[model samples]
Target chain A: MIAKQTNQKAWFMVLPVFLVVAFSAVIPLMTVVNYSVQDTFGNNVFTWVGMDWFKDLIHSERFHAAFLKQLMFSGIILLIEVPLGIMIALAMPKKGWGVPVCLISMALPLLIPWNVVGTIWQIFGRVDIGLLGHSLASLGFDYNYTQDPIAAWITLIIMDVWHWTSLVVLLCYAGLCSIPEAYYQAAKIDGASRWSVFRYIQLPKMQRVLLIAILLRFMDSFMIYTEPFVITGGGPGNSTTFMSIDLVKLAIGQFDLGPAAAMSLVYFLVILLLCWVFYTVMSNIGEESSNGGK
Target chain B: MNFNWMAWTAPTASFFGIIFCLLVIMTIWELKCPGGGPRIGILRFETTRGDRLFVSLLGSAFIHIFWLALFPGLSLYWALVFSCIYALAVFRWV
Candidate 1:
């Protein structure tokens, strides 16, 4: 291999990106940290309260409820979306005109803006004029997201599944496409059953993308705000209020900057920790497989 | 730079300063040592020095948060001690 010359000028190119990130992300994050520890009485007058807000947020029953509901929401979506996405990907046409059709349709939901998705579902699930709600109501199902907690939860879950499952499908399809034809030919030569081929061949190849899908879905679902906010408005007595919605309520509605900032920090940390764990565990599994089950 | 909009308190500024210092130190260490290659430790996963440092920092944050939650009356210095030990363990094993 040829030795490459070092280029000191590379830093100049990176400087622009570094500056942008510092301005956008680091500054806002510093502001949040600033708010987390201090009390304000309007007029930008602030008093240092140390970790009091964090302590209160840690023990707050409201926070606890939102957290549990957030966990449940994330868990439910992951459980549904991953397998559903895999199945859709596997069923997707591998070649010809069907490929573009499948790809375009799968990409459609993801291209929709989040709030538009929320609005789409809001109207779609309304019993008064919407198709789903009207059909369910006509079919004697008693489904009203605006009024019932269970209905609201179902609406939000379905909306999330519809919107995000495409992302998983796309990732899985890419993973599936990367598998060489030789592997499938060898499997066919061995007289492998469909289930065996899927279990031994398709699954192992899709593992990396599945990890990405799960992590993305997990993070997005955990921090869900717009859809539930638009659909249910976290109403029916805060039954559908997840942590982000609750944080927004605290920060904007009540203007409790200290506790809200504390909650935001904790929320950010929790997501970071969970994503780290998922990445570690999934990568470890990938390594074990690559090491021939050792 | 006029930074009044941030409402930066002394402690928060110091906290950010410490984080910035840590990042600088890490960068300097990387430049000096060159390769902080991945090593498998008690966590049974390959992690470089940078990864271990991240884990330790995140773990320390959790320790302080938990300490505040479980023992609100106690001084945070104990949590600091625990976090140091945790960081040491991560560096040594994870």
Candidate 2:
């Protein structure tokens, strides 16, 4: 047996990282907290307002609408992306020269910068000069994302699906690839049906990655800003105004610092709570299943 | 030294101060008694002391926010009391 040496120098090693995180995250967060509870005029003059901002935000009809719309967008995105990703992953080549080609193509969308993605989609959805818009117009389908709420939403959703479904596909592919050949061999020897093999073997194997995929997708879609912002600019009306877009409008456009700060805290807290719940439940399920296996 | 940009307010400062103090206390406690093992509670999920603390703090934030929203004219002291009780219950069982 070996005794581990305790070195106080480890604290010194950790100091740089601690300082970096404190400066980047903690300071900004403290500032946000300060702003949330205080009303401010332009010259950095501030007055304490206590919980007024939070109260107003919670009761605001505008806030409620944006939140509900955000929820629906994320819900629709997940409902589309996850299953589509899994199906794509299943259909992809397992080996040989085709694997690299498929992988590269899948990775391309993810590599594009977020703002660039937004710009691309913006231009891509324009009725005057865009392929998609022109094609739809030529086909006699009434589709103008600039004017129509449903068209705006469908374009945004489809753009997100195109951009991010690859992530889910890649994660699921890794999960699928990890399944040992012996499991398939065993299933084959037993004359197990394809559906049964997938249901019992593949699904369970993908659970961990699926948890990661869902959490990432949920958080990303929940806080989505760039693509939708560029494409629709929160609308012909306020129809596409997701929470983040509305927050930006309040904070930047209206310069309502107190309310915006309060809204930011609430938004952050919602994400934190939901992520915590998702992580705990999924990990518990994993633990129970592993225990049963043992 | 030059933290004027942060626009520090008393309430927010104290909030961070208390959180910092809680973290330090938890660290000391962990040093004194190692291994805060996961325990399944009423929630039917495994959580350690740190997890319980996180959950309590998060729950307290919601309670305070909700209290402000629902009881606009009321003092926040009652909300603090409720949060304290919530924390105690969480530490005891969850």
Looking only at chain B, model 1 earns a TM-score of 0.93
lDDT of 2 by residue, B3-69 (tens): 7777787778898999999999999989888787579899988888999999999999999988988
Q: Looking at model 1, give its docking quality level.
A: high
For every model in order, the fraction of real contacts preserved is 0.86, 0.79
Q: Which stretches of candidate 1 lie over 4 Å from their true place?
A: A1-4
Docking outcome class, model 2: high
| Tens digits of lDDT, candidate 1, A67-94 | 9999999999999999999999999999
lDDT, candidate 2, residue A172?
98
Residue lDDT tens for model 2, A1-294: 999988899899999999999999988988999999999987888889988899899999999999999999999999999999999998999999999999999999999999999899888888889988988998889999999999999999999999999999999999999999999999999999989988888988898999999999999999999998999999979999999999999999999999999999999999999999888888888788778777
Clashes of 1: 0
Index of the highest-DockQ prediction: 1
TM-score of chain A by itself in each prediction: 0.96, 0.96
